[model samples]
Every structure is written in structure tokens, then in C-alpha cells.
Target: HTGNEWGTENRAELCFPQLFNTSCKKPTTPLSQVLLFHILMPSMSLLTVTLNLLVIIAVSHFRQLHTPTNILLLSLAAADFLIGLLFMPGEILRNTVCWFLGQLTCSLYNYISFVVTSASVGDMVLISVDRYVAICDPLHYPTRITERRVKVCVCLCWLCSVFYCYMIVRDDLSQPGKHNSCFGECIIFVEFIAGFVDLVLSFIIPVTVIVFLYMRVFVVAVSQARAMRSQVTAVTLQLSVTLTAKKSELKAARTLGVLVLVFLICFCPYYIVSLFGDEFLNSASASIVFYFFLLNSCLNPLIYAMFYPWFRKAVKLIMTLQILNASTYK
Candidate 1:
């Protein structure tokens, strides 16, 4: 009777009964929750990938799209694309099922996740700086923010993300599953000191830089817009055209400011949770916050589609395969 009960328990709970004591238990989730997650997570992943891919193709295939600002955006989209394609699916699977992939795969996934996220934050900082220069120092913007310099900055951002994440997770990389307690589980915990450092570098510092720069950009942009409106009413035709261009730049800055604001709203909750410790929030609630964070990637391209006329044209061209024509770049 005891043997039969043990077998039933194993069948019901353990992910791998053959491994018995070493195996992890299967996650117990309600039918409604399971169905909801299955539908919701994959949809988020697909939308994120599809939307960011459009941005990637738009920036890469069109010669006219290759500017300093768009280059930063291209790098940002690439990181977001990876998040949707790789990290989201893995996160969904990890939460829903026993991890069957070996420990090394788990370690690498976490490492890449950190790298991509750090790169995304870095890209936002660069975008804010780009807008600040364009708005506050219009005369030098052309010479100061060139495509080559932007490309170099983007490359450096990615490299630093890789290096920084490696340093953070070096022990885990050296010995995969060192933090896991069972065969079917995958978990990594940063030490208190390391976690604190990560909080400052990854969350605090970047957010501070972004907020400060955008504040400056906002002030300058608003003042410039008011000046342009006033001058347009009194200026000669040549000066009127110049004011018109400045007004357009201010509009662009405002749109991108919206993007930055959305990013902060989505991002802050997750980091705030991290600061307090995951134990403070229930698992389900924490997962919801995380999904909200992931939702930003999907929203980004939608923002572009709504605000940028060029992105719409690029998508139309890409959909029709018109980009294959030799003169499409022209």
C-alpha cells in the first residue's frame, strides 16, 4: 500500500520520478491560470518579435534610415528583438514547466538575458543624449552626432553589457547549477553585495542619467518651440523656413520624450521589486510586473508606427518586398 501511494505521489508531483529524491516537483497551477499564461505569454513574444523585426528591417534595408539617431534605435530594436525571441519564451517555460535543459544552458540564458537588458537601458541613455544635442545645440548637431560616432557608441554599449553581465555572473558561468537545489530546477542568486552593486549600476545610474538629460532636453525643446512660434509670425520667408525646421525638431523631441517616459513607467516597477526583494511580492504578482516590463518592447515599435511616417513607409516597402529592388535605397 505504501509503495503504491509513493508511486502515485511521484506520478502526480515529481517532474522526473526516476530521479526520485534529486528531482524537482512540477509546478502546480490552476487550469484557468495555465490557459491564460499559455495564451498571453506567447502572444506577447510574437508581437514583440514581429514589431521589432519591422524596425530592424526598416533601419537596415533603407539607406535613408541610416542616421545617428536611427542607428541607436536600430541597436535598441536588436536588443528588444532578442528579448522577445529568446528570453520571453525561456521565462515562460521556466515558470510553467520543469527545466529539462541542462544547467549550462540555463546559465547561458540568464547571462544573455542580463546582457540584453543592460544593452537596452544603455541604448535609451544614448537616445536621450541624441535628443538633448539636437534640441539644445542645433548648430553643432550635424557635426557632433555623426553616423560613425553613433555606431561606435552602440558597439561599445553592447560590449560593455556583455562584459558587465559576465562579471556579475562569473561564478555561475564557471559552475553551472551551483545555486540550484534539484535536478529539474534552475535558479541563480546574487550575493547581497553584488545585488546592491547591480541595483546602482544597472538601475539607479542609468535612470538618473536618462532623467537628467531628458529634463534638460524638455526645457530647451519647449523654449525653442515657443521662440519658433513667436519668430515665425514676424520673420522673413527664409527665417520662417528655419523656424519651421526647429519646430519639427521640437516635435520629434516631444515624441521621443513620450517613449522615454513609457520606458520608465514600465521599468521602474520591476527594479523597485528587486530592491525590496522578490519575497515581498507574491510570485504571481511579480510575474505580472515582469510581463509588463516585457510589454515595453512590443509597445516601442507601435509607438514608432504611430509617430514616424518613415517607419510606415518602410514597413509598406518591406511587406511588398520592394526593398529587393536595387534603387529602393535611392
Candidate 2:
């Protein structure tokens, strides 16, 4: 009777009954929860992929859309695109089923996740700086923020992200599954020292820069808007063009402000959870917060669509396959 009871328990609990003693137990979630995740995760993944792809195509295919600012946006869209394509699906599978891809694959997945996320954060900082210069120093903006310089910055951002993430997860890369106690479990734990360093580099520093730059940008933008409104004179061609340019800059600042604000809203919770300890990392609440982080990649493109008429027009062109024409870029 004891043998039968033991067998039943193993059959019910173990992810692999054949390796019962070595395998991790399957997570026992309510049927309703499983159903909810199935519906929610896949939908988020699909939307993230689709929306970021549109941004990529819109920026890349249109000649008129290629500017220093859009180049920064292109880099951002590329990082978000990778997040949707690679990380989101892996996360959904990890939560929904057993880890069957083995330890090396798991380590690689974690490495790529870190690289893409870091790149996205770096891109946000660049965008903030771009807007800062455009709004705060409009006379020098053309010389200061050129496409060639922006391209160089974008390249450096990606290269640094790769190097930084490798440094963070170097131990996991060297010895995959060292932290896992069972065959079906895939886990990576950054020691407290490493986690603290990551918190400083990844969260604390970037958030500080973004907030500071955008705060300055907000003050300058508001003042510029008021100046533009109050300085109305006879509509000479030069004055008309100047007012139009100021209005455009103000609108751009407001849109990118929304992007940065949404990023903070989504990102802060996950890092705050990380601050508590490694124990919180594996909890169900942490999983939910992690999804919130991933949700930012989806929100970005939607923000673009809402704010940018060019993005809407570009989407229409791409959807109709009009971009395939050689003259579309012209």
C-alpha cells in the first residue's frame, strides 16, 4: 500500500516519472489560471512582434523617415523586435511547461534576454538626449545631432549591451544549470554582489539619466510652447516656418515623454522586486512583474502609432505592399 501511494505521488508530481528522484515537480496551477495564461501570453507575444515589426518597416523603408531621431528609434525598434521574437515566446513556454531544451539553451536564452533588455534601456536614454538637444538647443541641434553621429551612438549602445550582459551572466555561461537542483528546472541566480552591481548599472544609473534629461526637456518644452504662443506676429514666411518648427519640436517632446513614462511604469516594479532578494525572483508575483517589463516592448509601437502621422501613413503603405515599389522611398 505504501509503494502504491509513493508511485501515485511521483506520477502526479514529477515532470519526468522516469527520472522521478532527479526531476523537478510540475507546477500545480488551477485550470482557470492555466487557461488565462494561455490566452494572455500568446496574445501579448503576437502583438509585440507585429507592432515592432511595423515600426521597423516604417522607419527602414521610407526615405523621408530616415533622420537622426528616427535612427535612434530604429535601433530601439530592433531591440524590441528581438524581445518579441525571442524572449517572449521562451518566457511563455517556460511558465507553461517543463524545460526540455537543456541547460546550454537555457543559459543562452537568459543571456540574449539580458542583452536585448539592456539595449532597449540604452536606446531610451539616447532618445531622451535626442529630444533634449532638439528642444533645448534648437539652433545647434542640426550640427550636434547628425545622422552619422546618431548611427555611431546606436552601434556603441548595442555593443556595450552585449559586453555588459556577458559580464553579468558569465558564470551561468560557463557552468549552465549549476544553480538547478533538478533535471527539469532551469534557473540562474546572480549572487547578491552581482545583483547589486546589475541594479546600479542597469536600473539606477539609466533611470537617473533618463529622468534628469527629460525633466530639463519638459521645462524647456513648456517654455518654448508659451513663447511660441505669445510671440505671434504678422504671418511672414520666415515667422510661419519658425513657428511650425517649434510646434513640431514640442509635439515630439510630448510623445517621447509618454514613451519614457510608460517605460518607467512597466520597468520599476520588476527591479523593485529584484531588490528584495533572490527568493522573490521565483515567486508568482515576480513572474507577473516580469511580464509587465515585457509589455513595454508592445506599448512602444502603439505610442508611435498614436502620436506620429508619418507612422500611420507608413503603416498604410506597408500593409498595401506599396513599399515594394522602388519609388516609395522617394
Give me the runs in candidate 2 sitting further than 4 Å from their true place.
Answer: 1-5, 30-32
Can you write out model 1's per-residue Cα lDDT over 1-330, one digit (the tens) per residue? 699897887767888888877889997666756754688889989999999999999899888889898899899899999999998899887778899999999999989989999999999999999999999999999999999999999999999999999998888899999988888876656666777898899999999999999999989877887777667667588897788778778878887888899999999998888877635432655777887788888888898988989898888888898878833454
Clashing pairs in 2: none
lDDT by residue (1-330, candidate 2, tens digit) is: 699997997777888888877888886655655644587767888898999999998888788888998998899999988998989898876777788899899999999999999999999999999999999999999999999999999999999999999999999999999988888766657878888999999999999999999999999988888888787865789988999999999999999999999999999999999998877876665777887888999999999999999899888878898888734554
How high is each candidate's TM-score? Answer: 0.95, 0.95
Q: Please list all clashing residue pairs in model 1, or write none if there are none.
A: none
lDDT of each structure? 0.86, 0.88
For each of the candidates, the C-alpha root-mean-square deviation to the true structure, in angstroms, is 1.8, 1.7
